[model samples]
Target: MRPDELDTALNNLAAEHRLRQRAILHSPQGPHVRIDGRDYLAFASNDYLGLANHPALKTAMQQAIDDWGVGSGASALVAGHFAIQQQAETALAAFTGCEAALLFGSGYAANLGVISSLLGRGDAVFADKLNHASLNDGCLLSRATFRRFRHNDVAHLEQLLRDTPAKTRLIAVDAVYSMDGDEAPLAALLQLAERYDAWLYLDDAHGFGVLGEGRGVLFDHALHHPRVIYMATLGKAAGVAGAFVAASHSVVNWLINSARTYIFTTAHPPAQAAAVLASLQLIKDEGWRRLQLQRHISRRHLQSGVGGCQPAFGLAVLAWRVCR
Candidate 1:
């Protein structure tokens, strides 16, 4: 607990990270950016649509500021909720094909709000081995019995389901595994959810605005019902900041009433919402962006210069092409 000890520990962690990999940033988030004063063709960001720099989104934010001002002022339960926020939620629900949507300050908070709010002591939460840290942490916070199934293994998940007591169960997964670019087995996962009589929570942080006619993985799979609740981040492929949960109106009502993160934290600014709204439009209207992204990923992996990615994880491995 001494200051010297703390400093040494922090330095050790930094050294470890450097030993593994180091990140240096010197410019804005984009395809090409300066890293440590040197420009690099960047592929490290999640701005899949390249809409983060769109002038239309910026213009929309400016107009939103003119109408709704700057800060949210307080939490949604207080005076922070605005017409713009409601409008954004409506748009999100419509885009995702859900009953209702609730916006949050960020994706982390949104996941925490939804997961902890729904599952508590005695409830069993089944998570995929490689779900986001937020999902794992939310399960811990819920004081529920947590079980992690092998990543994308429906058979293993079914076995776990069979052993689980006939109680209310919550199944959590990421629609697109972040570190690994591979997607979830959506149809199979949904079938498992039905057989197990459990609620399926899909966090589409990286897939939103990039998949399913730009709707997301759930829509891409053509599966819909009351059993599914979707969570996504706007800061990723959506090319904006903030997060949301789209589900049945009753679920949204429950979160608004009971979710502490939503109740305690200040809502996102109206300007950000406006920017997201603009980005959403671009994502839906443009199909070429998605195709290009897919093609780029595939080609990069196939080229001997870049080297082949491990087929299982879909994880991107960037390497300098070595010339013979």
Candidate 2:
């Protein structure tokens, strides 16, 4: 099809959702931002800790730029991997309690690379109904037999696992449902994974840096066994950009060598990686941020004057939907 035709088709889908509101940001993301050529209250950003424009993070980035000269210049395998990236990856692994962590350009790339590399046509993949589009697209790209289980329903997941008879079974779930603002039953899901000898992939995009003392929903459940693979995005509560997969050393090496996204794509900027490192330290050392976030969410829950609806539970990536 013509490029204009495809653009028109995409526009039609956007119009269907009543999501055509376009706002321009003049400053870095935060609770209060310069939007649409004016300052406004912004609750839509993933900067739950309000650290994107933090002085420390900015200093770290500037220092990295001064030392590293900016761009990575090539893929990680071809000399793009620097000490900054290594430091950030190591910090992420320690934060997530994993033996090793592999960095990717974004959360979508991390999901796609991990899911597709580990599963193929002969595998049976079960995913949460409310999983992010990245997980769904990863399943499709993997050529696996994709099955959707009820969102956060352990019983439905068990039934699906019992029904599928593939040589390899993989279960994918979101630590926190993004749009619905709900959490997955991680303990139960991990139990099922252990019983069925399946690999459990948990995307903690909304939970990391805000849930379970900044460890995430899955970590809160203490599912640190080898069967669980944890994925998280730095762009969220970390107030930076990039994604990572924390798993066993074997899996990390496999992704490093075989995951197309990691192998083929240019490495993330070293400055960004340095900024992420600073953000990681803030998330770990400054426990008050997480506490404040919880209190904010609680305040929304107790608020009865503005809107009768309370904020969603188990996550703090978004504001409560208050319609006036």
Candidate 3:
């Protein structure tokens, strides 16, 4: 694009009130935060379980920094893998009931790496219309026949699956959509995937620490299948950094070898993994946090009767309010 076109685009966005800016953060992530020289109750964060500022995590991170230094010093395949990261991966795999798990620098990279590695020119990707931008970008990057079905519409997805002639197919979606506070029909989607011989990819960033007794969407629904690939970010409820993909041992192995993002980027700080370990323990022991979250949500959605959400996919999709 030329400079004149870029200027016009910026002017148009400003005129339409669509441009956004970053706010300066002055305090740790929590319900109450300091931003832009003001203290306010914050609901914009993904720290659903509220462990981002926990003392235990701070201590763990500090100790890790002292012991292991700040950086991993290289990529995971190039002597950057550490014992703590391995431990976190093992714990995460067991927690999610997957055969294996692989960590990525962030949720965006994880999605991009997993999707692009699994599908290429000959594969087809059926995604929800409201899927996160990273998922859509990954599909485009994979050079696949990307088909977007209506959000939560199983029939639309099924129709697309029936029409697609690609050999390898993938169905990708968010387990719990943050904007709507509604969950995907994992069981129904799994059925469709099995029927079409397509793999299902679930991004559970918002569901991990808040749903399924802090285990995630799979346990909440009691749904599991060999054709499912699950990914979640620790920065949300896990209260740290990095994302993990949990799937069959074979899939994990393939990602390790083929995912360009994972192979090229420097490993995330090992200290973050230590913080994640600390966060995991808190999530496991603290049942009241989940109850508190439920209570907070109920007051706004169930009691107030304001901003209620509608059902989708022939099932009740719960509404979620952004702020308290």
Candidate 4:
């Protein structure tokens, strides 16, 4: 597109009120933040457990920085795959009851790399209509047959699964609907996947560290299967950064060897992984945090009139539906 055409598109978007601007935050992320010099009670952060500002995580990160330096300086496949990252991966795998786990830059990267690497032309991706944008992008990028069923509509998904001729089928959905403050029927979805000989990819970013005694949606459903690939972000309830995909050892090995996003991107800082280790211990021991979150979810109507940088509804990354 030419400059003039780009300018026209921008003007059109602005006229439609589709353009969004950034808010400059001057304070740490949590319940309170300083945005545009105004102190606001922030419901926009994803720090579900208040761990982002926890002194424990801070100390662990500081100690790690002193020992490991700052940047990773290379991708994991190169020289940046630190022992701290491997430790976090192992802990996460054990926590999720998966055989192995691999770390990625974010939930988005995990979805993209895992999905695109596993499925492609001649395969099919059955996704939830309300899934995160990253999942949709991964499906499209895979050059697969993309089929979106109505949110949590099992019958529709089953029909798509039954009709697709692709031998490799993957069902992808978020464990929790971030905007709706609801959860997907993972047990039902798992049944469908098994019936159709498909795989299940669960993005549990919103559920991990916040649900099922802090074990996530899988624990909530008492669900585990070899066909399940679980991805969760540590930056939210874990209150650090990065994401990890836990699955069978063979699957993780395949991702490490084939996922371009994992291969080409710089590995997350080891210090952040240290913070994640601290956060995991904290998540396990602090049952009160999850209880407090349950209270917030139950009493959300009390915050209906509260104001902040967020609107009535939007992306899960920007606002907590639990507070809406």
Measured by lDDT, the strongest candidate is 4
How many residue pairs clash per model? 0, 0, 0, 0
**TM-scores of all models?**
0.90, 0.91, 0.93, 0.92
Candidate 1 structure, TM-score to reference: 0.90
| lDDT at residue 86 of model 2 (Cα atoms) | 94
How do the residues 119-222 of candidate 4 rate in per-residue lDDT, one tens digit apiece? 98999999999999999999999999999999889999998998999999999999887777667889899999899999999999988997778888778888
The list of candidate 2 runs beyond 4 A from truth reads 1-22, 304-310, 313-324
Candidate 4: where are CA atoms >4 Å away? 301-324
> Higher TM-score: candidate 1 or 3?
3
lDDT of 2 at 323: 18
Scored by TM-score, the top model is 3
lDDT for model 3, on a 0 to 1 scale? 0.85
How far residue 167's Cα lies from its native spot in candidate 1, in Å, is 1.6
Candidate 4 yields a Cα-based lDDT of: 0.86
C-alpha positional error of residue 136 in candidate 2 after TM-score superposition, expressed in Å = 0.3
Over the full model, what C-alpha lDDT does candidate 2 score relative to the true structure? 0.84
Q: How would you encode candidate 1's per-residue C-alpha lDDT over 1-324 as one tens digit per residue?
A: 887797787788788884345678877666577887788776456666677777889899999999999998888899899987888899999999999999998888888888899888888889999999999988899888899999989998999988988488888999888775678888888888898898999999887887788899768998677889999999877878989999999999999999999999887797898897888888888887777666555555676344433221222212211110
Using lDDT as the measure, name the better of candidate 1 and candidate 4: 4
Ten-residue segment with the worst summed lDDT in candidate 1? 315-324
Which tens-of-lDDT digit does each residue in 21-84 have in candidate 2? 6777897866566877888766577777778888989999999999997889999999999998
Candidate 1 CA-lDDT value: 0.82
If ranked by lDDT, best first, what sequence of candidates would result?
Answer: 4, 3, 2, 1
